[model samples]
Target: MNSSLFAVIMMLAVLIPSGMQAQAPATYYNSAYGKSGKALKTELHEIIKSGYVTKSYDFLYTIYEESDTRPDGKLWDMYSTCTWTHGQKKCGNYSTVCDCYNREHSIPQSWFNERSPMVSDAHHIYPTDGRVNGQRGNDPFGECANGTTLTNGLGRSGSSTFPGYSGRVFEPVDEYKGDFARTYFYFVTRYEDLMSTFSTSSTSFSGNAYPSLNSWSIALFLKWHRQDPVSEKEIVRNNAVYKHQKNRNAFIDHPILAEHIWGTLQGSAWDVTGVETPAELLARVNYNANERSMMVAADLGELSYEVVNISGVRLLSGTLLGGDAVSMGSLKPGVYFFRANADTLKAVKKFIVQ
Candidate 1:
């Protein structure tokens, strides 16, 4: 589906929700702000001091696996087309975790010098297949794919185009055009400032420098964004990745959230309410009266958060006192929202009962 239509679908899903907002949960805030390199290091130290699990490489691996979730043994998995089972042939037919697929950077890293940052930046890294990556080549994504006459060596055609420069361009499969579109949005947001230092065979951004990306690439991505909207799976993965990375992508975060944060941070606009955030940041419930609430406590332990009642209301919110027994039997319970916050980090959870 096109970006617009995909957005509409997401909107409808959000509107028809069982009480969750159409927007992202409060956890996105935790994923973005309130951390510096030194602060992160300090926080990691504190976690270690508290005997929390803190592995440097494990963090990256956790995010990678959560983002990819490939049961088929594909290094990175993509959404299934036919069924909902992970790696199932023609999957994505079910609403389960199977719909999300592993996408790739259309501009392969190997084309560049395989520099330290670009190669390692997980923001641009994708879960596309090795076969497709080889087919994409170093071509800039562009309009040549519109024509039928062109042919790529891999039986694909029309991927090459006038990149507004001497080099070539490539096109993505129709299904993933939107994925690349958002990925490009993410790429620009993550590295637009350093782009001038980036080595390119052609000067794609020499002129018409408003949003500042290769015109061919930008145009194609914009078209894809407008045509094939983001999927629920993509949005979920984007947030999950953000949770792991502690940075927000312009394309991945809800467009509004990105706009508000970017405008305020970039000084492009004066957003007064930027300081105001969801109540989840303050406190939440960590235990329940009825069941053991194993998963509920697990979220709190991992995220260091608290819980609240439904309706965005707060209940018991604080740091984990680490007592095995947490009292909750006194409160009336239909549904509840448990949350936790550490500076800019926040996590929300839902629970239900009799």
Candidate 2:
């Protein structure tokens, strides 16, 4: 079908669930004028034009905070201050702000011949580094080659050891991998037409030989969606960007947004039998979390859970029980996992310190 119709169908699919065809909760209002595809396309152009006056490469550096030698001041350095100025040392492995980053293009501008709206799109561009961007290259993302050796773990860059798929892929550090994966998902879905012209042998592309995403790319994206899932940071940034730019993407709207899109459009669900939350039988087993002694519970039917930090290291897991409180008194004063699982439902709740 057409892009507009396709988006509508997908949205509908997301609102309604499978196995049971109950009406969707009226929580989300379609703000896209009932025209998601073309309207978004037009909106993208407008957003770019509006930001044309204020956007500068320098602004990018500021957003992530890289060291600046330029008289104009450094964007990266400023961003670093925002993210990690509290500690003298960088929160990440890098020793300095400059060492830690580059102004990364979330959507490689090359796909649209480096067009304006797509080129400097703030929604997709991020402050990454050269090494990580190089490893990521233009290849579509997927499971790395079995022997893929890591070049820069901090940048999340690596070469796949998998035959046929052995290519450079910028694997994101655990913290933002899910966000990056979701960005790619949003990009392709947004620009389905432009996707065909781009290369697609690696995990970076859709892997579909037809200039569109092949099944492999789709499957890989689905996997990435799970492994390096969304974070609170992304949500905060997403809202900030939307407010600042007056443009928003569905992927940035919610973690489960993709599930809705894919389910509605493709009628498929993300598989997670081996990858989902842990068993509920482990409940009542004390686990340390977030420097606070807390209780954990699970609802087997819902796959919902909570995580209380007993120590710094987060004891995170999924698919346990929901509403079933587990004790945290015996555990140490650090991060802990109080996972809850009930079928396909899943969440990672973070608790604070005393």
Candidate 3:
């Protein structure tokens, strides 16, 4: 933990309220309200693409310094456990895992003919280990069986064991499955207009704007998105990328948007208006000091919860089951908070985490 990064985190801890929700600036989704299904996706695509600021491929390196910085100040590389210093070590040659870092396009560049705009879109371009990025080699994400593990034991490459697809795939660390899943959602929606014209394509594309994702991808991504809810790491990174890109990942801001467009709530009109956020649901919940545990309010239905310190860094995250006590275990004395998706009930709590 370098002094500067530690200081920045501590300062953020104090400045960001424990219960504050990470969402858009009030009306960013205004145009999509009350729309559902394909109409909602089209409106959101218009909103994001219009707000986007164009930059170059090389400029992505500059953006990585901020977007991928870990809490410990090292570059946050998902593929390998390399403690990288931003702007210092870049991919030139690599014989092993920790050789250097490079940009990983979650969606392969070849699928879109390595063209501009999509080629440099920061939303899916990640800072990752060079060697593992090579290993992943544009393989679509999926669960694996009898796989060759990547640099870290956290990821793997092999035949897909995920229900729908049986092709070769690359599975990232469990911690980042949802991150990548939502990133896919953003890519499909933000670029819905350009689908047909792409130079090449993957099996994941449905060849139309309505349900841009293939059936297999639709099921796989929905599962990943639900199991791995958004984290403080994602929220911070989302804000950082928006600083340079001028557009935000709507899935990160409002995860439920995915449901309206493709999942369980597909036909329901998307209405963010007049919605009471999780902060407003605090009255229905309470902390159990003796149990050292938590859960979403019974009325909110099941959800995923994030526990964090006064500073917004995440401490723990898991399924927010039926109001049954979920053990939080030990913690240093300080004000901590518990929160869930703003799209789902928005149940949050401010309590001394211990």
Candidate 4:
């Protein structure tokens, strides 16, 4: 064989096996294609349920050491910025903020009465400062306004400041907001059937697979999911957990799936079509905000568009021809979301109407 041909064959041999391995696990989601709402959520639950390996609470320490460590090789404590030595703070009682970290149930165990799988689920458990973990104490996540009780740079526990709920709650820093939102999304979907048996006093979780979160909490989490987006840390942790638990969080794999299941973007657009990357969908259309109009690329073919306010109220809806502009001249000066939809395409862009 020619040297060049042999080199090409060698490269292919090395790449083929790794590529196949990467694609194998995701094949579990094949049945979920073109599904949305309750159907999508239930399909995911069943697909992921098969691989879940329940670990004891004690096992989490070993897992966190591998999964939650910061790049600097220190324990990654979400509740505080304190640096912790590895394994120094495993489940120890603390009266104040210490140098050690402990297992924190982002979803408190008491909420489910310490049920087996839910109690030990690493998807919702994090390693955080022991003192701050105590302060959080099963509180539902929310923004704090007044009556501050604990402030640890990275998290806070206090009276609720967020609208729609006025109970005490714990709020993590902005950096991890999307991370927690995805985790919550995973919790509701993966354990949708088990939610009815858990406490709902401080939770927004409902028993149903669709609309699993109550209105207020859903709105808050959706906003957070968009604002923070997904980060590399989340992607890395998600892959690590999949290795241990044998299931993947579909929301992390496809962030838009959350919208299909519970948010405003649901319908046949997402139901009949598979998920698309934001860039792939956005590349199909272009918006000229100065003229308050959008132009669909010819390759995208004909499409429909809607202009909605930040609150998701539809202000205008119309069809757009390929290569032609759809005017938004009648829209009032404000912020709005430009949503484009086609048979197999869905994209949303935020624009200011000034």
Work out the TM-score per prediction. Answer: 0.46, 0.57, 0.78, 0.70
Preferred candidate (TM-score higher): 2 or 3:
3
lDDT of 4 at 113: 90
lDDT of 1 at 18: 23
Between candidates 2 and 4, the one scoring higher on TM-score is 4
Better of 1 and 4 by lDDT: 4
What lDDT is reached at residue 31 by model 4? 85
**Model 2: worst 10 consecutive residues (lDDT sum):** 16-25
**Model 3 lDDT tens row, 78-115:** 78777889998798898888888889999888877787
Residues 1-354 of candidate 1 have per-residue lDDT tens digits of: 465754554443333222212344454334334433323223322321232122342244445555554222233443123222333332223233333333344446644466544555455565543343444456566555453321221224343554444344555555456666666556544544455555555423422212446546555565666444443345445555555454544454433232322222333332223323322222233334346352322222323444456444556644553233344554573655554443333334344433
| Candidate 4, residue 288: lDDT | 72
3 or 4, greater by lDDT: 3
Clashes of each: 35, 72, 2, 0
- Candidate 4 wrongly placed segments (more than 4 Å): 1-24, 147-153, 269-354
Candidate structures ordered by TM-score, highest first: 3, 4, 2, 1
Best-fitting candidate, scored by lDDT? 3
Better of 1 and 3 by TM-score: 3
Instruction: Give the per-residue lDDT of model 2 (tens digit) for 29-118.
Output: 233222333333333324323333335554544433221221122232212222223123322444333345555676565555666556
Model 2 deviation from native, Cα RMSD in Å: 13.3
Task: Count clashing residue pairs in model 2.
Answer: 72
Off by over 4 Å in 2: 1-56, 62-100, 145-152, 155-164, 196-212, 263-265, 268-303, 306-325, 330-345, 350-354
